[model samples]
Target: MKMNLSCCLYLAMAFFSGPATIFALAPENEVTLHPTTWLGENKITAVHLPKGRTRRLYFTLKKKADLMSVTVSPCAVPIEWSLAVRTLKDKPPKKSHWTSKKSMPEVWWKGSGREVKIYTYTGNAVDTYTGPAYAPASIYILRLKSNERDTQVSAYLHEGPGPSGVFPELPPDPRVHTLGVGMTSVTLSWAPSSSVVVEEGQRGNRPYYEYCVLVNPKHNHRSLCAVREGSKKDENEQMRPGKELKKDWWWHQPDTPEDNESSSALWDNFEDPGCVCKDTESVCTVSDLLPDTQYYFDVFVVDKVNGTSVPYTGTFARTHEEARPAVTPLREGQVKWVNLNGDASSQNGERSFRFKPRGWQQNGLLTMHTCNGTGKVKVTVSTKGQELTTQEVGHELAQIWLHGGPSYLIQLQASHSDKSRFCLRMQASSAYHRRAVPVFPAMLQIKSFNRLRTCNSVTIAWMGTEERSLYCVYRRQIPHGSGKHSSTDRCLDPESRPASERVLCKYFQELDPRRAVTTAVISELDPGVLYVFDVYLMRRWGLPIKYHSKTLRTKSEC
Candidate 1:
């Protein structure tokens, strides 16, 4: 059967942002020095700095370097660091010197047997540095030297998880913040470090970087699956971790089963599509998540320089099963509707009729209305059943308007099980559109009002009945005899294309707990025009009959 999807697009946009950009170091440039996992203890062994014997770094281009050394110093030791450089290609070997620029130079001793010293270099102008730790011993360094002649630099301290020099800062990492717990896998993202800066006759550096997102079990800390960056979609194969079909994106299974588990496995790794990005855009997908499992994820942004960003983590819990729709009771004085073919009509006291018939949408439409008036009126929202409400329902009716008719069945149910108290009723009308009707008549009321005056403007506000579903405002000219009624074409035409219809002046929505009534204020009305307004609580759209509020007029003063 046909269903309307016109409103679903807006909801989809709020769920997914986009893939994170992978920043690679320049071509042929190395960012990290760790050997593959097979390499034994692939860490730095020693750092030699003999007095008056300068340790020179001979590289083709200026690049940022991260040098770390294991240190054991008193908690009161004052530590200082700086940078130095020498041009091997320049004649006479010209050397430039500069002090390291860092705030809070004193690194605290964390009451440990050994502390690691980390030095960052940003500026490429200098050749060498002379600082407190310049002569430290057993220093292990991970340098990101560049391959180009001219460059820029800055020193940024490493923060968060993972060993230093293995990551770089990016945007998407901080933006996509939800983490699913107990789930097989999760996705993480960070913002890109650089976007192309356009200029005349200058081509910006553009290189595709690799991404390595890892997940470790929270308890034993065993490595799970590691998916590559670019991979094909294969759900069955991704159930467990192994060699992924994608380039850098991979999938991993937890070393141990989750303590509090759900049914399905996690589809954590999503390789972004790049060919579409040649035109400057791309798409990535992550699937196969465990049902009702929670997972923590960390993303690494890698580039050709081997620069990776520190891990950004978040958590989310999957549902055991997809949610199914169910009918909920309506609020007091509110009405709902379900349209069948135009065969039934309201007469005498038998105002309501059952609408559970086959082929309803193709053959006709069902309509339901609720009376929200201050005093009780005959409310007949559903012919099948009815209920009273003091607040709105969490879920409302959904509609799908599409061409090429499809046949479907429509079912109408009561708000409450009480059948004798038929406070609401329904009647079949010639209206083109149909909706859900209420079972009882409503008594509408103006709940509250507010007034404000400022140097530049004046405003009036009002509260609606607690059962209100929709609200609107209107204006009228005060009665004047022999007073000049300037006819400057003040009437606003409500019929333009949907693209230009401004009839809906203001609106607000709350989906978590559907409370019906809302407050609104009108602005920019002329000082001379008498403004009138009203609010309504209708259960369905396009049912013109309303349980409307008492018209309140405002004094025009600005």
Candidate 2:
């Protein structure tokens, strides 16, 4: 009888074992957690698990508890459970610590009923627990957690065209209002940008701003300043906020409700605005710059929430200096070289020369005199390119600033027939420099045509200069004109030639070499005629040389 009774007890214990282990509960429960938010697309969030400190999480009750222990899954990699237990609220059970046999490899976690405990996770992570809890249910917060993300500053740059000296302001419409002249300083301003706001139970903070500016001298496609932020003067240090700040001064104030004052004045250093305020436009003023030089600049703006903005840019130019050295009618000159032949002297400190600028107005030519060691110097006439040409004459590396009021190439180096080279030097006259005008190149086109008695007519084209002494027109019955045309006709004055003898096509003197000027025309020819036209350069300084072009043809029809 005793043996049979013991067998019955053993069988009853085995049948009830599974159901008894199902309702065991733990102290903490796992709750539903939301997905983690990423600061940027390529960022990861994580935190260092403090030594000896284990994590606890709870999930809301779902269905019925049917298992012995619960489990929580790891986010990035595989993990094992360290300790799991299920408890019943209706029954007051004895306090006992239940531990697991598997050790935590870097990270470990275990879930019991509706709760989970994690340990040893490192770097960045996000863990989730899945299980059911006992009845008497109400929704609760889940402890879904992760480590902090690493942050850094991403640098960028912007570039644009600048002026020779100063720059202009940023126009309302960037594309339309541009600076043509160089300015002393540049200004940068931005539109208003919204700030991020904090919720009811959050901390208040102020948004900090930063900026950088760069100037590229060579325009070498590289930022001149490695880090070009604005600066604050020493005198502006008394602007920090005191103990208790207002709600608007806090960092998390939303755009609509609270009005936040900008720190542009502080960050921009109490100077001209250089990309500090998004609401107001700012200007960057630079000084102590060189003249007739070009410079490039770049600007960058920074905010608290989104960080730095795409760089904005503008440029300015500086005006020329007061006295700039220059010369007029650069190439063709009146008085070239006089070999200080010991006895050469200015008759009465007066020197003068005349060249007919036929079609050109006389006021266009300007003259200035310079002496090696001061024998005598004076200019007899005046015109356009420059004024007071004679008064500027001097013995010490003297220069003559000429305007030419037109395009003129001054002779820098002239070699005579004897191969002697003379270099002309130029200097600046305060008066002349002040009166200097912009000169352009003048174009002279000389076209000639030949007509024989009821035969053929051919036309030829060439360029002429205001320095031509005279032109010679030749006509022979072909088959003999050959290369001897230079000796055929007497040189005729290009200005006085009539339409009957030889047509005067173009005539120009005292004209702006910088502009375009054409010569007179020679026409009314017989058919089937052959003619040769030769033009010569009349020089006042060095050896005179002649330039020539020719054409042959039969008269045209009708």
Candidate 3:
């Protein structure tokens, strides 16, 4: 989708209205920081702050902390920048300049060149009007702005003393496995990440964790699996209690605030092929993928509370290739039943059948029944490269409608790599077969009840002497020049309606020998309009047999 100039102007107008407006305009820009990022040392480096643009970062503290600190430093060429800290309850500053004396308390620093500045607060008291402060269960915002020219910078944050108890360790890499592969989807499963228990003497706490599956069409290097650069620290490199341990980003993080603004222009063309699983789920099915192509997957265990993640590498799979359809020949008035059985290992668990509506047979009906099998099957019907319908069935009868057409293709595949068994029966017939002769001259009669007739609808009922047969009802408005009372013994072909006529409704149904009558409601008619309805009995071969016809007019007023 292309955004015109007007759309860009509208977005700009909405962005400057308020923070809420900006968030609503570009929700993907809002990134949730992990608690570890604020409780422990975290460094965001090489962030490009474009001139005249402002960037804001947010973090929330769930528990009380004794100390909070933040540091901002310029990198490479010296540049002018300003930083400010605010809590959720603080109001927006009215002044435009960050260095104004009125903005001093709220603005942590306004510096030029390559100077580094650190802001700190201690204890539970929070100075809402001045300086960076600490408070339990509160959200804080760090706003940064660049002046003069665009430049890069690095920012750091730390809260101490960190949790007195042991910190939760990063989850170990998972063992990935491919359970099944389809033409457009792959099912994967892995062992759940082991729970990390934090112990403080007698009390123990377990942190919740979830999984995120990242998929790339091409292979990714193993080094890319680490969530943070230089995160694989040895025992000697581990930070001691109360000591800051900063982890920097070797590459830009997509979810960072600066990157979000810098990359906003490319959002319209980027597609992310990643999915998140529930905390308890170990199996996930990735779908809507290209067939006959290999894809790499990396699964990560994420700390739900802290938003930290650990990645598992070296997992990939390829989707199955589309199988060629098997053609089946149809004879006039003949019913055919075919059974298909296949295993995923050999057949990829997919089978397709194609049939042409030869002779006068233009209408077709298909019923699929799954036999005793280990997996369910999905059925898709298409023609001329256009898909008509699709459905999944198991151990039940599924009827599919094939509108009048020259040919149609039906594809069936198992949901997974397991033994599949399906029994399908198909029949083709014409709505107006010209060659078939009737066995009974007056076997069917169609009737309409006056009491059931409304201004816009009428009930049609039919009774037939023969059982085990299919019947179709068709309706069309009578042309202006035609007599309202005119009736015909010949049935009009619904597929070949004239320009003056239209097939308002065309549907077929099967009748059992034990049933005496079948009724249908034809609705959505114009007031006082005359319509002709034709009833035909379909045969397995040749043309359909015209059974009965009727003409009715809707009341002019209700």
Against the true structure, whose TM-score is highest? 3
Give the distance in Å from residue 199's predicted Cα in candidate 1 to where it truly belongs.
15
TM-score of each: 0.22, 0.24, 0.26
Spell out the clash pairs found in candidate 3: 333-540, 333-541, 433-543, 433-544
lDDT of 1 by residue, 110-217 (tens): 111233334444322212222222222112233333332212222233222333432233444343343332234333334443321121125433333333344322
Higher-scoring candidate on lDDT, 1 or 3: 3
Lowest summed-lDDT stretch of 10 residues in model 1?
70-79
**What's the best-to-worst order under lDDT?**
3, 2, 1
- Model 2 over residues 259-369: C-alpha lDDT tens digits? 233433223222332222322223443443455656554544344332223234434344345332234432343345433222212222222233333224322333333
What is the clash tally of candidate 2?
95
lDDT of 3 by residue, 4-76 (tens): 9888988788877877775455444333332212312453333567887866555544365556555454432
Q: Which stretches of candidate 2 lie over 4 Å from their true place?
A: 1-180, 183-213, 218-280, 303-310, 313-327, 330-333, 336-558
Clashing residue pairs in all predictions, respectively, total: 124, 95, 4
Which is the winner by TM-score between candidate 2 and candidate 3?
A: 3
